[model samples]
Target: MNHFASIARVPGDPILSLMEAYRADSHPGKLDLGVGVYKDAQGLTAIPKAVKLAEQRLLDSETTKSYIGGHGDPLFGQLLTELVLGADSQALAEQRVGATQTPGGTGALRLAADFIRHHLPTRGIWLSDPTWPIHESIFAEAGLQVGHYPYVGADNRLNVEAMLAALNQIPQGDVVLLHACCHNPTGFDLSHVDWLQVLEVVKARELLPLIDFAYQGFGEGLEQDAWAPRLFAEALPELLITSSCSKNFGLYRERTGALLVCARDTEKLLDIRSQLAFLARNLWSTPPAHGAAVVATILADPELKMLWSDELSNMRLRVASLRDGLVTALEPHGLAQRFAHISQQRGMFSYTGLSPLQVKRLREEFSIYMVGSGRANVAGIDAERFAQLAQAIAHVCVE
Candidate 1:
């Protein structure tokens, strides 16, 4: 008997499948906006100069190949914790926050999901309706009950009121996943006032906030982007945070990320961290060290830190410019006002409000590739080909 015959082939991930299709297309003007990676104007995802410099320093310093312990690098944990939660964060001062290094933002999220499943087994996790596709699968794979709260609606806009209404109905003590900035899939983000309203509902519902800080510096200034998470950390007695250095530090492949826990006090934090460490040991004995080590080295050095910050600022500004440019380029087609939200939306992605049919036309008729949900990575746009892209989009919209 064939043992493998019982298993059925699974469908490929939509975004990844789109990538394969884009790669196979022979069109000279093919465009790939499916994957969420920061590409340069030349359409290359090159390593940042500061990251290269840090790697050279790491190479010269001569480090051991031995395991960095179950919790990963201590220096990385310390610095990354401060990077997300301000250095002078009251939670840090009060010894209420603890950090653990993970493979990547996805790993951090998985670790968090496992922790919730094992410890808070009775509580289900709530995600935004149009969250990153991986969010749903990750939690479900961990054997945890998953639910959704409204985020984007039929009108294709951030419906915070609907979101709060859904949150109000969810049982108390359940985990609520919130995007700190640069909301995935849909680029629409909750403003300060919206965050406050959500915070009130969280307090009333006694829900646990699990803030996902994947694109920290991409949406706005790093400091500015941290406002929501920091506010929750300060006000709430317990909070869970997953932060990624992939976008900000351009450390995508290195898989550098951290899961931070904020508790009522040092005693509670220690208990929570012990559980996290135990869970991480089973998931990924020890995370890859090179990425974390490089981040630590750069953050430790003043000059290198400045260089990284400047590079990060440039990437953020470039994405913003692309968003604006795409909208302006659509002006000739009289579609600028219709797609004006592209500029209003921050970060690497935007929901273009293109129907599935329109998206299909862009891929088949033109060579443009984006998710069927109309989610496009703004950072992937090549300014030189903006006019071509605009024409393709206008063509699809009109059809």
Candidate 2:
């Protein structure tokens, strides 16, 4: 008998399964709101102008294809640290912050999880109830006890009060994983006042904050989106931030990101970075070079940096417009009240509040592919098809 024959098959992820189903859908107008990817008005994920230019420059000024390092690109780590923490951050000035590039946000998260499990063995992690689904599995896979704090309510609304209440009860010195900007699956973000309140609780309880800054520019403006993380860095003596270039830089396939570690002093930071490098050696050895190099090239050059910023701003504006447009499209159908939160929510996703049955109807009857939980990718909404999409939404919402 074969020894390896008893492995059980696991079901595919609902989101990826939805994508497969959407692809097999022969409907000419099938819309895909399942995957958490940005799509333009024309329904294409085009590379940014700056990214294209940077790639060209890289091709021309090509050098040896040697390995980057355990920390990948130093320039990328430095630039991304500033981008996430702000240039004037005292943390940077004090040399208390350090970064190590990972494969992507997911990899950075896994790195952080493993680091915590290995180093801070006693500390459990607290995540939002409806956080990016991967957060649960990542920490658990690291053998860390994962607890959830209330975030979104049963009504599919931002229950910040409940979130704070839960946070208050978390064990002291536990790692609290937070979406630094643009809360995923449900685009509801905390206000400035809310951040301050959360900060107070974290300070009081002495919880370690592990911020996941995936969609920085996709929320508000670039600088504005960094507000919460910057605030956290300033208030806390130590922090762990995982920043991704997937959404903002359109480097989705490149898998470029970094795990940022902030300590009370340079000594602690260096030790933390050494441990991360050791764990990373056992993981991927070194992160991919192409994507990080592209990001560094764009950010270091003044002209390319400006162009990239403008492109990022365009993507942000487009997503915001899509959210507003969907809400407006529903107004004439008398759904303004029912779907007002769509306009209010931030980033690519919206907890549209459509029931599972309704979501099934939308996919089967209207060829609109969205998560069964009604988390639609607002970025995938085609500008010209707003009215048609609204009609489908209204029909299902009423049925």
Candidate 3:
């Protein structure tokens, strides 16, 4: 009589809970560092000028609402492939790389996971110790074994040596999921030298590389941020890359992304893509069109592409500036050294080295919100309130 009564309620996500708490707080100084969305200096989530232009172009020229195939828009996929792997890239030139549109980066990851589960079920997914929390659940939910190598530790530092050491020992042919750039949460990225070392480990241990390239242009320049994935693609006979247009293109809601597969040859890539299309058919019927269309329009047009790149550069620089500004602000409080790594880390987030106790105080006493793990959305910071935040952090650190 009560079939639903057997289900138990689960607690809300911590980040969502923080959002609710932030909204209900009466304090005017309340700061929300919880959500992953980007905010400008004025604290508004902006639509880039290029996006508006592209939307207008779509409005004027669009004709059909018909399905764009299981792989989504062909042009979007083509352009996105070039964007991730250069037009002159060997994979593209040799016709060994394939891409299929997905709902978003998350969808791309799920699609890839399902593809792997169906085709390469024996391969365990190796994630970073402190990777995006959802990665663990996504792969596990797909019935794949999930494992982690060393990454950032409680001391809020990168353990690259440990990471390299662990990767050297993981079972051969297991899949290793690596953030292409702008690593989440900890924001600590492997340097060029470090990546080379990791590549050696990946080669020595014979691990498959699955590069999660969500924030392509969010770290340094677009090309600069893409170095790791490009290197991996060029070096490995086969690689998996999931590219998202959410952050750089400001198409967060539109959910534009692609799952890219590179193989040793065209025939293998064809077989692999066929499998992905089959998995995608059951997953979402077909990916959304408007976002992919918009992305295609912008990337294909020379003028619009330049404008979009400039705007993306602005966003990337703004976040980097915020990192520096926060550090400069912290200097007066004498806490700069403790959190110096924040400046060194590139991306929209930083592990501020604050313990859970200090973070609790910031939430309850100062109306400042961040994840319990001390992960702060550096983009959500108010440039004007740097000193105030520094003072608040200083107080919490000492008191």
Candidate 4:
């Protein structure tokens, strides 16, 4: 017998596996609202116009192929910092902020996990109970114990009281992972007032807050979307932010993201940055160049940046409109009352509150695909299919 026979099969990813099943279905009206990736009205994921223009500009340049520093391109990091932290951010002005480019949001998360493990090895990580599944898995893989904090309530809203209770129980120095904006899966997010409360708790407990900002421009305007992270950085003595361009810039395949560490002391900031660079050296040597270059180009050019913001706002409005349409279409079927929560939720996803059996029925009967947990990517639905989707969901959800 071969000595290598102990390898066991790992299960497929739930979201991607659903995508494969959707593709294999030959049903003419099959709908896919499973995956987290954004899709336009035409159901296509096209590159942002700003990105296309930037690529053209890059093609005109004649740059060397020399290896970038372990922190990746310096200019790209600067551009990303300004884009995420704002031009007049006090953190940047005081030299208390440090950043490193990564493959994307996932890479940033992994890097942050490693940083936590190295700096605060004794403290575990606390995540929202129904946060993006990968957060817990990534932290656990980094040799950190992971715990959960209550987030969503039975009424399909943020359980602020319960979340506060959970936060109070967390030990000092523990890392608390927060979805800066656009909470995934459930789409329920904290209100500005709620954010202030959570910030107070973090400050009081001396907990480290790691903000995951993947869909910044998807819920609101870029500046408005960055308010939470900006506020946290300004108020908290220590913070870490993982910002991604995958969704807003449509650079998913390019894998563009940055990790920002904010410390009260400049000397400490320098030390943390060095450790991040050392980790990068071992992880992938250096980050990719193309995606960050494109983003930097767009951000550096005023005209291009304005155009990108306008396009992002349009996408946000369209998704919100689709959420409204779904509710309207389900009114006659008596599901409007039940699904009103969908319209109330923000960002690209909405937990439809459908039971597992109902989700299964939608797929088996109507060729409409959604996560078994009833999370639907609202951006995946267009005007042409809104009525059909509503009807399918309503039919399956009938008592």
Candidate 5:
């Protein structure tokens, strides 16, 4: 009779909780640098013009509300795979690759986790020591044993040597999750040379690579950012890739993403895709179609594709500029050098080196909000308030 009463209450998401607190604060100069979503200079998350145009076209041409099925929208899958791996990818030419549309990158990841849990039952998963919080929970919920490799060292900088060492020690055949670019929470990314070394280790140890490519065009240009994953796909016989269109296409609420698989040949690729379709059917039944339709429309047309690319480039530039502007603003307080890593780091986030106490002080006294771990969304920074934000940071640094 009391079966439900025995369940315990779960804690709210830390980032979302921070958002609620920020909204409740009455300070005129309150700043929110906690949530991971991209914001404009005016503190708004505006949709791209290309997406608007695509949606309008879709509305005019659409006829029915029929389901798109588990593999959802074949054209979307084809184009998105080309977008992730280059259009001229050898894997595609060889018919060794397949794609399954999912609700979002998160859904894609969950599909991968389930596939690993069911098919590769003996294998465990290895993640970065400080990956996106959801990664930890998702795999565990799927009943897979989860482990972590060192990513950031005591100095709060990328310790690739440590990462590779830990990765080397992991049991052979285990799955290792790697950020393709713009590593989450900590914006630190591996250099091209570093990736080669890691690739060597993975090959020697016989590890399965699962690349998370959530921020493709956010860190670098689309093609430039895809280098590592493309390399891995080319060098390895089997690989899993989860890609997101949230930030690049500004389709956050629409939840459009895909899980791409690369096998040794066409026959094996088909077998893997069949499994993904079955898993996807049990997860979300069918992914929402509007987002994928919009992406396909834009990417299919040359002019609209160019417009979307330009908008994405502008977003990347703005985030990069904000990083530099914040550093420059801190120079008067002699903090530029101390926070110089902020400039070197790419994408929307930076591990700002603020301690938990300092973070608390900023929230209570200055009404400035950021994760307790000091991760800040660089895209959320308002250039007009750079000086004000810098002053607040300086005050916290000295305290």
Candidate 6:
């Protein structure tokens, strides 16, 4: 054996493992409710019409293949900012916002983590108790202490009081990572009133808010979905925003996303941008140009932009419909009261409140795959399979 064989073998990702199991299942009707990526009614992930149009435009244009600058394309960053923060954003107009294109949302988060480690190494990072598992792993890999804040309540709703209590305990200068919208694993999100209270705590406690927004158009409409981040930017003097176009824009493999830094002063903004560029330089050197170019093309074209938004709206509605359908299917089974929270939750996922054993049974017996933690990706279900899923879930839960 080699001398460097001390490393222990680690298990594969729970979500990815479920995907593998789903692929290996011989059952023709096996359903895959694992993974965060979006799937259509046909259970296929395809390029959107807007993306195809953008690709045609890019192919028609004669642009050089040179490497993007340290901060990527300023135009792309500006377009992303306007898209997320709105055109008339006071922060953008006043030059208080700076952004950089990243490989994807993961890249943006890693960059933000690295930035935090450099600037506030002593401060611990707070993530939701039952957040996307990757969040904790990424922060830990960045050599920072990670802590948990209560988010989901026992009733399968947002635990605002417990969240506040956790925030109250956070010392000054710590970083708090918030899912700007569409809380992962558990679709429980903070209401606008709860957001206001959280902002108050952050301001009073002098905590840094790092908002991870991966599914903008997957929740409500584009504008409606962006309310949380826009509000955070306007209320908070300084904030960090990481957004991805993978789900909404259907650019998953293209790895397109951005990291934004909003500060009260221009000098501080410059410092942050410079440090981010430095981090990017050592990391991936520069993000791929194709996805950013494609996004830029779609956003710059009014017709294509409208088409993209419309498609995104359809996807969001489909997921919402599945949520309602699941509840309805469970009603006659006498498990409606237990699963009513599924419909109330928004976005792509819902914490089904199933125990680990039930989740295992769902996979082993029914050939249905979901996260081991009982999180189901609602977007994976079509209208036809709603009854099957609900029946399976009810059977597993009641037994």
Local distance difference test, candidate 4: 0.89
State the lDDT of candidate 1 residue by residue for 1-399, as single tens digits: 899988999999998899999999999998998899999988989899999999998899855889998788999999998888899999999998888999999999999999999999999999998999999999999999999999998788999989999999999999999999999989999999999999999999999999999998898888999999999999999999999999899899999999999999999888988888899888888899999999999999999999999999999999999999999999999999999999999899999899999999999998899999999999889899889999998888874
TM-score-wise, the better of 1 and 4 is: 1
List per-prediction Cα lDDT, in the order shown: 0.93, 0.93, 0.92, 0.89, 0.94, 0.88
Deviation (Å) of 156 in candidate 4: 2.5
Candidate 4 lDDT for residue 277: 95
Compared with the true structure, the alpha-carbon lDDT of candidate 3 equals 0.92
In candidate 1, stretches whose alpha carbon ends up further than 4 angstroms from where it belongs are none
Count of backbone collisions within predicted model 5: 0
Note the residue pairs that clash in candidate 4: none
Of the pair 5 and 6, which is ahead by TM-score?
A: 5
- What local lDDT does model 4 show for residue 125? 94
Order of candidate numbers by lDDT, starting with the best: 5, 2, 1, 3, 4, 6
Native-structure RMSD, model 1 = 0.9
- Can you write out model 6's per-residue Cα lDDT over 1-399, one digit (the tens) per residue? 798789898999878878888888999878888888788888888789999989998889947999988788777898999998999998888888998899999999999999899888798999998899999899999999999999986666678899999999998879999998889979988888998999999999999999999989877778987888899888888999998989899999999899999998788899889999999999899998888888888898899999998888998998998889889988888888888888888899999988789989998899988887889998888679778888888788775
lDDT by residue for model 3 (81-181), tens: 88888887887898998899999999999998998899998999999989888898899999999999999987788999899889988999999999988
Off by over 4 Å in 3: none
Shift of residue 32 alpha carbon in model 6, Å? 0.1
Residue pairs in collision within model 5 = none
Q: How far is candidate 6 from the true structure (C-alpha RMSD, Å)?
A: 1.2
Candidate 5, 355-380: lDDT as tens digits: 99999998998898999999999998
TM-score of 6: 0.97
